[model samples]
Target: SDKPNTIETDDSRLDRIEEMITNPNERIRTLENIIINQKPDILNLKIKNRVHERKFWRVSQILGRSSQTMATKVVGSYANDLKNSKIQEKHEVLVKKKRLLEGSMVTTPVPTQKAVTAFYAYMSKSENIPGTHHTLIFDTAITNENNGYHPFSGIFIAPEKGIYVFSFSIRLECHSYGPYELVKNSQVVGVVFSDIRQVCLQDQITGTMVITANKGDDIYVRTHATTSHIGLIPSDDNGRSSFAGWLILN
Candidate 1:
């Protein structure tokens, strides 16, 4: 009963069925041209016949595997590697403080209060040309909470193109110069000065450094001080200091 509806492929009925299923559009037209251009000799080519037989044998073997133990093993190993790759280690930083008791150890944290008293020269330019001035200054003075001094100053440069050598100075009234760090796009590029100096009484200190910049690149400086009178002036005399350099191809 199952063999009663078997369709034979070698008959002309198969050809009629193929013609009925074919479309008369560009794809069919292109295929017809190919079939006509490569006729009986093309259909009888040795390489094509061998390739077709090999492909059929390969498909038969794949179907005979019935779930394929080797294939399942390989796929399972790949999945295991992917699952193991997602495993991660976690860590925590201690933020609590401690105090000493008569006979026991007490843990506590000191309260932290931070406020920005003054900020100067916090400027940004969308159109930054070579040798142009892009200045950032902190002009406000802050009162120390519990006589604690904290002052910071720097210039941030976002340039379009060219090399730049930037130099500036900070002047504070009471705090000692703690540290000066140069960062390019949040990355530490240079440590201009790391030692403490008497920047309060001197009224001025100059810093000079060089850096290469590309299009849309930025450069800036920052500081930590004890007093509020600290300011980063780009020049010695009211933005008189020049940070000049050239843009070159690396």
Candidate 2:
């Protein structure tokens, strides 16, 4: 019995050994296959980590750009508000200045003249009356307003441009005869004859005329050209030689 048991045990052990030898390194090969199957998972994990890092970096860049943009907008809004406030202050100042100017005096143009050519003149002496176109001078200006009639020069210069009325009276002794003419700008305007012949014996004659005179025209009284004028013009008690003029708008 002991012999049989020992032979059976040896056979069984030999058979088991032979089976293990035939399928060599089975456990080690199974472990190697499992490691190979897990290779894709490991690679995927590494790729996921890289993607998360890139996503984190992109989010950080966006936040930095957003912060800078927000700061710039704030500064721009503040600048705009300051500029608008300054403009409003300037407008208010301008309005105040305008009000002050309105309260001040409204300045006007300088004054002007309306009357200048009203005058009268007369001779204050007895004068001999005989000449050829002799200018008779009235040395005294009674009412020479603007002195348009120069009493010394015996010339009435028109003070303003318009029509003017002029008149003159001349005296002569009896039997003295001559034609006195009012000369205007080298032209005879009118005539008055004072011939105190024995027929009428007039002491004086008067001449009146109207003329459109410029501002600087000349007017005077004179004897007619080369006429027989011989007399003493007695101006003391007999009569007076007078010249007067006034203006009328044309």
Candidate 3:
């Protein structure tokens, strides 16, 4: 009886041990299954997060481009406004000057005889020379009052303050080219050029301008410094090359 009781106790303890081990093994298998079933959901969540991040960056880039475009438009509008303001200011100044001149003309008396008016000149001979800033001499005089035009020096001294109409004509000889400028008080006022490189005989160029002059202002034509070739064709009777001017208003 004592042996049987000991054997029964040992069997009970072994049964308890086996139950504990089996229970833990079943729990572990269930947990592993749960984790395996959730793998697709976890991957989906990660993909969604990456897509949202890309969309955020794309929206940020669009907003940045829009901001830059708006800034450029603002700058352009401001520049246009500034240019218009400057133009308006210039127009207002010119209007004021015109009004002042009109008032002065009303107070001034009209003279019976005009001021020093008649002056004209022309070149009579052909010339072919290369020079820098060389003055052109006009040997033929059509009408010169008060000896205002000096033929030797190729300069015209204004006799009185007035508005004058000036004209110049230049003829280039065959295979030659010349560029000339009309100068007033050492300032360039107009330009004339002639090129006979492609022509069989000659090529002519003419320029004219109306300018206001002060007394003693030096006016003349000179060969341009940048011109490569120099030759002028002139005829005494044909007046192919000439420089002439006359007073128009006082």
> What lDDT does each candidate get?
0.45, 0.83, 0.82
Q: Lowest-scoring 10 consecutive residues by lDDT in candidate 3?
A: 230-239
After superposition, the stretches of candidate 2 with alpha carbons farther than 4 Å from their true spots are: 1-113, 199-202
lDDT of 3 by residue, 153-242 (tens): 778898988998888887666677767899998799988776776766856788998899999999998888566554545555554578
Superposed by TM-score, candidate 1 places the C-alpha of residue 146 at a distance from the truth, in angstroms, of 44
The C-alpha TM-scores of every prediction are 0.28, 0.53, 0.52
Model 2, 1-250: lDDT tens per residue?
6999999999999999988976677877888899999999999999999999999999989988998899899899999999999999999999999877776535544467686677787789877755687888888888887778888888988877898889998877777878888888998888888666666464767888988888888988988877867776667555687888898774
**Stronger candidate by lDDT (1 vs 2):** 2
TM-score of 2: 0.53
Candidates arranged by lDDT, highest first: 2, 3, 1
